[model samples]
Target: MTTATLGRLDAIDPAARRAPRYGGFSWTFLSVELKRLFRNSSVVIFTLIFPVAMLIMVGLPNKNVPISDVPVAQGGMSAAVPIMISMAVYGAMVASTMTGVTVAAERTQGWSRQLRLTPLNPVVYILVKVLCGLVLGGIAVLITLILGSALGITAPVGNLVLAGLLAWLSSLMMTSLGLAVGYAFPAQNAMRYLGPILPILSFMGGLFFPLALMPDGVQIAAKFTPVWGIANLSQSAIIGTAPDVWAIPNLVVWFLLFTGFAVLMFRRDTKRV
Candidate 1:
């Protein structure tokens, strides 16, 4: 080779050539994911429309019904308050779990394999999925809250805001659970198995009604369910009561459990590829 060609060859770093490209998280990728999510009309219908509709149907008649003997000014809230919050939680749960559909689709399309070929860390990829789920969940909660306000579900502004925050935070576990299910099942089967979990948990956790109204057996069981703590915590502000002492720990433990399960499944899927 000529001297100039030899110099050019020598300047190229072997280490750089061997290193993987596109290794870290990027906001651009997150934005693309969000946009892709919103493009799905089903997501909008299920996460936004359904919840608001349920809130109106259930909350309108109960708007003036007092939840307890205490007055609203003295800390008691309307029946509509809990109904509104529960529907919000329900919507958020559905939105978060929809992550499974996207993940399974990616796997089916060989996108997971493509990602594996890049320097992108698997954990970062999973984090991006979780964030997308959270964004969808947040939107679900917000839309429900706006509808609730219009339907006359009144409460202190602080309580309303706090309840909304708690409802959004409660979706973290659902996001991780969605990732776990997505990584565990085939594309077509992922959502089929995942769809009924939230509604069942909501019923058992007394999100649809007071635990006290449940049978003695159900009330006891509700205390141990994944949704119970977060549901109670979210509603406590509106109810003007202290949440159970176990609420925080319950939320933390379930989040860790789901996150761990998701990581394990992700590693397994990666290895399979």
Candidate 2:
């Protein structure tokens, strides 16, 4: 029989391992998350079908209405055009809630704790969750896009290619936000209260209403929430315009803040010897 030797594994600094270690997370983990996301009827109805319904609701009767004296050829183009952006923002918030529930549920099932016991780096575990959530959120966005196209909902000036890029980057920011929430709260109780949080933020997001319509100071403060900034950028893009420079920076800052918070919490959790 072959003999093996064991030594102080923990003492062998984690940095020495050039390649990363992971919890039970792998392609298997990602596939499972995707499958589970689809299986959840509420997620399907809310994140998936709800946007389509909203699109149709807004697209209706607007076919002959002019939004702003601009010939909307076959369109109000949906004054609810902003709702596409709003829908995405809404979905991402749901992503945060849903992903947090995913992690929390996984933890309840002992997946996270067991994975932590692996050779996997804590950082890798956190990264994978965030990446997985981003992918899920991206898929949801694509579904919304498909519905918009089928409904004859025109995408302002943005070509599909440009819009895709915007969605990818915005999803990246949102993934980080989701992770931050996932790390901050205990999974179970979070979901219980998280349901209400989305609508409040969506309203605060200024998606249904223009920030200009709000008080000046509220508009300024809304910039701190990544949702507001992305909503502004996406709405402008859909309206056939480029977002202002400041808007991009707002997204970047929130992205960094969320990333930092998530990493810090995950690292602390892994410190158990």
Maximum-lDDT candidate: 1
State the C-alpha lDDT per candidate.
0.83, 0.63
Q: After superposition, how far is residue 59 of candidate 2 from its true place, in Å?
A: 5.0
Q: Between which residue pairs do clashes occur in model 1?
A: none
What would the per-residue lDDT of candidate 1 be over residues 1-273, giving only the tens digit for each residue?
899999999999867765434557788989998888889888768897888888988878887777779765566678889888888888888888885467888889888788776777777777887889889999999999998888667788888899898999867888888889888999899988887877788888778878888899988888888899889888886666789898888889988898888888888888889
RMSD of each: 3.6, 4.3
**Clashes found in each candidate (C-alpha, N, C closer than 3 A):** 0, 1
lDDT of 2 by residue, 1-273 (tens): 223323554357776766543544578766766677567676556666665565566544454455576666634455545556566555655654475456655555666567666676655566666676676676666776777667666564454546544654666665665565555567777566666766666567676567778998888888776677677677677766677677888778877887787677666654631
Using Cα atoms with residue i matched to residue i, what is each candidate's TM-score against the true structure? 0.88, 0.78
Span of 10 residues, lowest total lDDT, candidate 2: 1-10
